[model samples]
Target: MYPLLEVHLDIIGENASKVLRLCEGKGIDVVGVTKGCSAFPEVAFVLLEAGIKILGDSRLDNIKKLRRAGVACPLMLLRIPMLSEIRELVELADMALVSEISVVKAINEEARRLGKFFKVILMIDMGDLREGIWPINLLSYLDSIRSLNYVELLGIGANFGCFGGVLPTPESVSMLINYASLAREYTLSDIPIVSVGGTVALQLLEEEK
Candidate 1:
């Protein structure tokens, strides 16, 4: 027999609920990431039942699975999108993490062609050396995005403890907050969400820093 991996759905649901409660108390919304489970509908349903209003996955195929399974909540594409996949991405995902202006333009074009509006989280690289653009270029990206009709700048996000092993510190978290503030000032939009990547960020909340 192949090595079997077992999941206790009850335990997972309990944990997710606990985390959701914690985050909600802190005025934070959690995006239940389904990538770890390959976006399996069973697990996705568990998360949804536990009050996860949004689901995130790195693969478009996974998003498709959730959609086909009748998961109706907003779906977020966690990975920076490929230009070639922009059309389907615009069709499938409600929001995405984007770093490159070219990909954003492609998404805008597709959304316009389909007569659909798309949402995106502009990613900033706060020394994580990951998928986000550097902070200095933020204004330029915002400028370009502001001109797009179909693409809406949903918020700003940053990755940590991934490629560069940069752990999330209070300073780093504050920097992300500052960027969100700057973006709002420049775009004159609310820019409500400020997302932080990596499970390690949970520590900051725990420490209440």
Candidate 2:
């Protein structure tokens, strides 16, 4: 016999579905962040069943746990990856939010060695001062990474309401969108995912800006 915390699985599932519906109605896809729940497999499954196409977790171990539990959604590392974990990150996550070019280069090298294609969302620090390339240097950074074969430039993203408590406003998000446009112009390709950070932005989704 073992001790376990009691949980209302049905309610959990209902809440997951409700949130996903709300976000989807507003033209946003939910990542179903699982780190807060310690990446519990059952809870993760509830989110998956509720139509979460992407799973976001801060820790590599949690990502590995999701895969071990047979969750099929593409996993995203919400934090900038460490060089030491590049091999596992490449093997596990479908995409990662990144800031430093050096780390991306390492990911590319590891992916090449493993014969795998890795995806990255270049994070920009839009006054939040967290993990992102400075806006001024972004285009130059894009140029440097364009020739990388095994690494796919997924899109650009930013973190707000994080360390700096910077609220993600219409203006801030617009700035991120503008950066995405610049990225597209530089690469001459459609930037696939311009991820707007945090649950706070959900409140503003209805506005047609």
Candidate 3:
């Protein structure tokens, strides 16, 4: 007999609904991350049906797949984009998480060439030690990003538990919010989004209950 894996999408949808409801109450919108499932359209559909308006993935290929499948909701690139893939990333992703000024510049240049605007979420390193700019260097990056003509600073985000095994705490969350405030002040624009949650954060919430 061949090995088989069964995916119970009904249960997944129910859980997604619960999380969506909780986030909605707190004025938070959830971005359903599909990298774990390779951005399978079926699972992505379940998340959308459960009220996830934006879909996020770590791979540009997965984003392309979702687009090919006709999932028109806003797609987010969860990983820091590579400079070489800037052109395709600009076309496939509605928004992307970025930490480096060079990559942002590349994206901006490509967006200019394509005659399209691109959105970016600056990533701050809030004790995660993962893919993000150091808190001390944020202002410099913000200054550079603000001067860009084609790329819009959508907001900020921080990774937790993905690397360095740092657990998400209230203090960490507060730090991210503080950085978001600083970004808004420095950019002189209302940086609307502050993405600071992940599976570990969700598990923390579950443990609190």
Candidate 4:
């Protein structure tokens, strides 16, 4: 048996449902993030059974594990795409949060090799100073991505708690929405995922009416 995470299952369920409700009719979807020891396939399977439409994690291995266990759902990789694991990332992930067109190029090439469409969320730094495209440079980056092979430009995302100071708020969310909207001026609508990062946003998500 594995070690327990001591996560309150009821809190998880309640949190998941609460987050989903916040996204409902907002023209966005909450991919219930399962990385906080809750990333295991069994726990994620429970969330899926409860009607969560998406599962998110930082490790491609977890996605691979879940797929191997037949716990298939719409899996999203929340980690930065490494230069090395492009092949496996392409094979296992339905989507990812990324920072560069080079990484996007790699994902697109791998998707082409596998003959599949890959969804991707461009991670914007958004004053967070973390693993994402610099906010000032993001529009150009999005424009650059428009020519890539099989990337479905999902939306923009940002890490709030990752780099020490930034926290998720209505302001941050609005900033991200605006940043993503700039891209929309160049492209079309239906940009799929706007991955607001970490548990704080998830908490605010749970706190929504």
Ranked by TM-score, the better of candidates 1 and 2 is 1
> Which digits, one per residue and each the tens of the lDDT, describe model 1 over residues 88-160?
8988889999999999999999999999999999999988798899888999999999999999999999988
lDDT value, candidate 1, whole model = 0.92
lDDT of 2: 0.87
lDDT of 4 by residue, 112-206 (tens): 98999999888887666878887889778877788886888987888888776788888888888888777887676677556777656756655
TM-score (C-alpha) between model 2 and the true structure: 0.93
Tens digit of lDDT per residue, candidate 2, span 1-209? 89998877789889888878777776777788989887899989988887788889999999999899998789999999999999999998889988888998999999999999998999999877877888999988898778798889988999888888887888888888999998998899887788988676776764544
The TM-score-based order of candidates, best leading, equals 1, 3, 2, 4
Candidate that would win on TM-score? 1
Ranking by lDDT: 1, 3, 2, 4
Show model 4 residue runs off by greater than 4 Å.
1-11, 22-28, 202-209
Clashes per candidate (backbone, < 3 Å): 0, 0, 0, 1
Candidate 1 residue 197 Cα shift, in angstroms, is 1.3
Which candidate, 1 or 4, would have the higher TM-score against the true structure? Answer: 1
What pairs collide in candidate 3?
none
Best by lDDT: 1
Clashing pairs in 2: none
Of models 2 and 3, which has the larger TM-score?
Answer: 3
lDDT of 3 by residue, 85-171 (tens): 888998888889999999999999999998999999999887768889888999999989999999999999998887888887878
The Cα local distance difference test for each model comes to 0.92, 0.87, 0.89, 0.78
